[model samples]
Target: MKIALLGAESTGKSQLALALSAHLRNSGLAVHHVGEYLREWCDTHQRTPTQDEQHHIVQTQIARVMATPADTVVIADTTPLMTAVYSQLLFNDHSHDDLALVHQALFDVTLLTGLDLAWVSDGLQRDGPHVREPVDQKVRHMLSQANLPYQVVYGSGPQRLENALFCMGRQAPQWAKQLARQESPTRWSGLCETCGNGDCEHRLFTGLLVP
Candidate 1:
């Protein structure tokens, strides 16, 4: 199934996508985590994207999803509708952002992240903590208007994941079930061997630290 984690920025969508993908993969499920392409574009440009640039962000995201291996389940960090909603809020010129709804129908499930968590500024692209709630409302409004089936996930990081699984009518995978019983939150760990610093320590989202 194609499960999408979406909503306003810094709502733990990225971390949730990573955790969910990892959990599914551990369960012997073929999963592909389609990350947000706009993040890369913004980081490179060091500025919030213009309406024209936002289209490129959505287009690249579209291409990435299209390019995924057909047999694998997909967990997208954000749906294209996120772009449309943000576009309306930021540029006041959605510029075909509503077209994202056409693509939204393809997803098996969509999870909207809540704004109860901490917000961290990533760069010029972020609107910071204060803007999160209003943008979150916009996301909810847009999703409701489009008649999409979505579940709003809230709580601390681990609880949020459990909520998403429940919303999707899924139980925790074997590994996840085991992790949930553990007392030490830092028990889950991995290091990204490819990072140039060789210090890319990966931690499971036991709590929301940073995405």
Candidate 2:
């Protein structure tokens, strides 16, 4: 199973990818995690890059995803579609090859990370909280236009993981199914009295963002 984690900045996409990979691996499943290549690029440069630099990042990300061994499940932190969205959103450059490649790319499932998660600023290339919704809309638009199989993951903490596992079908663990059955998630306050990610919802097999 190839799972693509798609979302805007600070939507928990990266963290979810890592968490899922770890979970599956711990379950004795083979999993390869495709890290965000842009992080390495930014770490090396010490600043955001120009439009030219973005092409390299996008292409590198695609290459990394492609190079991943897919005999087993592979979780991508962010797909090239995200790079295309960022390209259009930030540089206003949509003609790049990355957009075309991402549109053509296929995945067994694409989990659209909800914008209603805790925001973590990486302090360099990260955008502010205000752009989260708009960028999320853009990512959803791309997925819709491409006619991809996707679902919105709309919670944090355990609920968030359960939603994703449910979308993954049989790939989900027994515990994940149990959790999904026990708790009904709704759109919670961005922060909770105890768990900041409480009161969220699960939106599987949907085109909408679950809003």
Candidate 3:
């Protein structure tokens, strides 16, 4: 199954994804961790492109990952929603059409790691010419408006990782546990019914189980 960890900058998304991957691996599950595409693409191109280009690159990376042949879990650090937020801020315009495309491109489950925890500003550089708070709020609103299936994870380090794990496991236990099983040779190359139909939000995030 594919899972995405999304949030604002310096919110520990990458660290959480890495920790979750390790935890799942220790439990004997094979997982493919997909890092942030925007950063990687920027490095490859040797120059940061406009927000529109970044949005396109994010979509392209997600499509590539979805098409990849993997037996177990595929955990993505960010998704198209984040790109849409960046686009909205940079372009001073938002499109329902673009948002629809992003909403349709996401995985069955998306876990939104929040910025409620203490801010660790180290290693956090100015991402292009954008400010942080506006970008963070834009992303939060995008996820909320899309009505995507997501859980708010709060904390730092292991606490944050544990919170994310619990949220994802609760929302998608079947898919999460399936990682422990043997990998299937056949991959889901095309978009699943849930992917294109926009119905995954209802089925995945409804009825949260309080621990």
Best by lDDT: 1
lDDT of 3 by residue, 54-141 (tens): 6576567667567655677788877666666666766764643364346444576677665444455543234532365677666656
Candidate 2 residues 1-211, lDDT tens each? 6788887888888788988888788777788998887777779888877877777877787787778785877788877777777778888888663464453366777788876666888877688998887888787677667666577776678767766776665334453443343545433333322121223232221323445
**RMSD to truth, every model:** 10.2, 6.6, 10.0
lDDT of 1 by residue, 1-211 (tens): 6788887888889988887788777867899999888888778887778877778888888888878898988899887888888888778876755578877777877787766567887776578788887887777777678887776666566666655665554322442443343343321122221111212322223233565
Judging by TM-score, tell me the better candidate of 2 and 3. Answer: 2
Whole-model lDDT per candidate: 0.70, 0.69, 0.62
Model 1 clash pairs are none
- TM match of model 1 to true structure: 0.77
Least well predicted 10-residue stretch by lDDT in candidate 2? 192-201
As a whole number from 0 to 100, the lDDT of residue 159 in candidate 2 is 68
Local lDDT at 183 for model 1: 49
- Relative to the unseen true structure, what is the C-alpha lDDT of residue 117 in candidate 2, on a scale of 0 to 100? 64
lDDT for model 3: 0.62
